[model samples]
Target: IVQTYVENTRLIWYRHFCNCTLINGKFIFGYYRLIPSYGLELIVEILLNTRLISISSTRSNTIRKRLHICQPFINKHHFEYREIIDIKTNESIYQLNLVVVSSNKDTTLIRLIENFEREVLKYPNRHQCFTLTILYFYQKNQTINQIYDLIHQLSIKYTSIIRLSIINQNQINYNRGLGRQLASKLFSNKQLLFFLDVDLIFTGQALDNIRQLMIHQLSISSCTVYFPIIFSYFSSMFNVNNRTVIDINSNIGSFSIYGYGNVVVRKQDLDKTGGWEINNHEWGNEDVNLFQRFSESSSECNVFRTVEPGLKHYYHKKMCNGIVNRERQKICYDADGVLLGSQRNMIIIPYGMSSISTIDCSSFEPYDKPISTWKTLVTNLNAAERDYVKSYLGQSLVEQCEEIEGEIDSLLDIWRDYRNETVANCTNPTIHSLAEPPVLRQRLTTEIEFFVKHI
Candidate 1:
């Protein structure tokens, strides 16, 4: 029995148009050049198993429509191993060909290891061909001993997927992270590239979940943000005076959800752009970083979103490591500034009741509804309105205002005294000036960059 193995047993691709290498060394649009032309028949043959196998990383309408048009021809041929593979390894030890998805950019080894465990080892797929291989950012750390051990363990049970070099981290740039990963994934025998996040739990239906996210054009997409926990906390401590809001305008085309900690991109678009943005290293902002980059750079970055129903985010535990609670005051001031800028009506409409919540009720219900009875009763100026309301005199507004004014005044004075004490403890000449009185530093920094220039 003679068995033949084709180089591309699976075809992972994105939804958008891409340029492919032609026989004569020229480049042309892959979808446009191939779909309506003679390549359609060839694709049909691959689909039906005449002489090739067709597997895509996406389930877009473009791919679906094209596949449907060639359905009759595809149905004619029957190949033995033509399938869309969602890999999951369950037998503990299995040798498999692994494709490390990365770019010469921002993917740190720590981030890559997290991605590997979440996207690869966490899943249970035994369909891969290579004996044992690992995909990741191999530069962030010097320890390959642990990876070697994992591979050694896996090689004992399965003989298909085998170990290879750890993948490179993506090079930071504008929008080429996905493209780089695609190029790397294309070289492997298996047409699967696990695009894992630095912070994600790779449990339960990991492969299937990734496949669903791949439908929206890109290889994979994480769930939308719904549980407003992050936003709510930020608002309460940082922007207490302002309504907690998530900007929908920021995500024009890409569906913006609030809670997804990460996603797994497929291999198709990875080939075109190279990999994730290496330029963006700022924490709290990598999600939009790659998505925005790919949307602009690759004409073929068809990515999608998947919901990790019960997924856990382990990386978020470190959020409080270097943060300062005092910094939250800045957020409060900024939010108040926006509310003041928008006029007083920008206040949130009271939901259940007005007294218990900070929400203002002037914008809705009786106030807006002129014909409503509640409106008439409240605004109606009868004998009660005519009566001089000065009947209930208490502390004067000036006195009350003066009390608030004194409290704030005393608070600032105490801050000044404490600040002076802090200045004495700091011996470092470099940071000695930072201990200056808050008001004094504020005034000096505004007038000149003398301190900044020195530090």
Candidate 2:
């Protein structure tokens, strides 16, 4: 009986199932109907001869106004217009999968989720094909029932357009990078993955801008990643009169080149870069590490930065108590061997390093020193002591310490010569500008060559 039912269903599908295609400005439709012996009936229908309208051909504002005006008509007679509209023609264009990592901060998480929902509803077109996945770390501070109730309420509220999925981490950790890495694996089917911090407050206009940028990047076959030039407004920048509004205009030019507050990239690009560094936890250079890996993956992969204004970041207190301030200046170059930026005044401490107590003291703070000094200290420490430090400092810090030490030693001679030349030319420099001089290109090239050979 089961074989007979399967054969009948296959025959029906073979006869009637067809992909809707546009030919000569008209769509070809498919329709199917099946009746079984058990009084089960099924029907599939597709609107015929639909006119394909390219979203790019018309301004979004005009389309929005038209949609608003025809909303009532659309509801009254949905069938008449169903066959004439195709907002998105490319079936595999892009689908945005938003990943949010949350923890015991229930109130803040709730507020952020609510704000996102409100913004999404205001600009429905921006999130037309979007899904929200929340990775909640189970914290002892909040009861499990409370979390379930909050998730249930949210699911009911945004049931129309947004598909919401909640993932609960059985064990809680301070490492946000690890949580994001795990959450990313859940959305393997989605083309674009957007990682957003829960503290960020996004406006409707900003979301629309992001949507347009992602769509444009996806449309370009060569462009594999899209990074937005994020403008940050600290907690102090919030309007005193209205806490909800942020004054982002005041700090217009002070934008970070590699802002990770909200990162949007194709899943393939992320996969190529091995995704976020799972070993990173608390506050570290996880974003910078991922960016570097992405650049190294492919020269053909284009990274475009959107400078449009729409998103604002809110500052919060640090979760860890570490005072290891590493102030060494390192010239970091991009994938094209161009000087992108310099790393300086970095606070390098392992996640949860300060939380553990030593046997001799109630608390311990790792002494901040140069990479070379740290390497010497590590070498001099006993086996048991080194193991203890390793356990507390985590793998990321241990590897970084070793790498920095090697890099510094390898580049010491070249750096000394370059410095001497720079000092001699300082008195009678040809260029007085703040920008890097063309004469220094040789020095930078040498540094890059050294890195390629050793790194």
Number of the top-ranking candidate, with TM-score as the measure: 2
Clashes per model (N, Cα, C within 3 A): 67, 0
Report RMSD for candidate 1: 22.8
Displacement of residue 161 (Cα, Å) in model 2 is: 5.0
Cα lDDT tens digits, model 1, 1-455, are: 00111112222212222322111111111121235443342211111112212254322211111222232224534735434454344432122223333333233433444444455544445233222244444455445566556555655544444444444443422223432343344343324444333333333354444433333222232211111111111212112244323221111111214432244443334434444554433233344445544434123333333333334332221222233444443332332222121111111111121222232223222212212222232234233221211112113522332343344335446555665676678766664344435564454333222211221
Candidate 2 lDDT over residue span 56-109, tens digit each: 552121110000011122244445431222347234345566778877677777
The C-alpha stretches of model 1 lying farther than 4 A from their native spots are 1-144, 162-164, 167-190, 212-261, 279-287, 294-303, 316-455
What is the lDDT for 8 in model 2?
A: 53
Error of 1 at 25 (Å): 34
After TM-score superposition, the amount by which residue 131's alpha carbon in candidate 2 deviates from its true location, in angstroms, is 2.4
Model 1 weakest lDDT span, ten residues long: 21-30
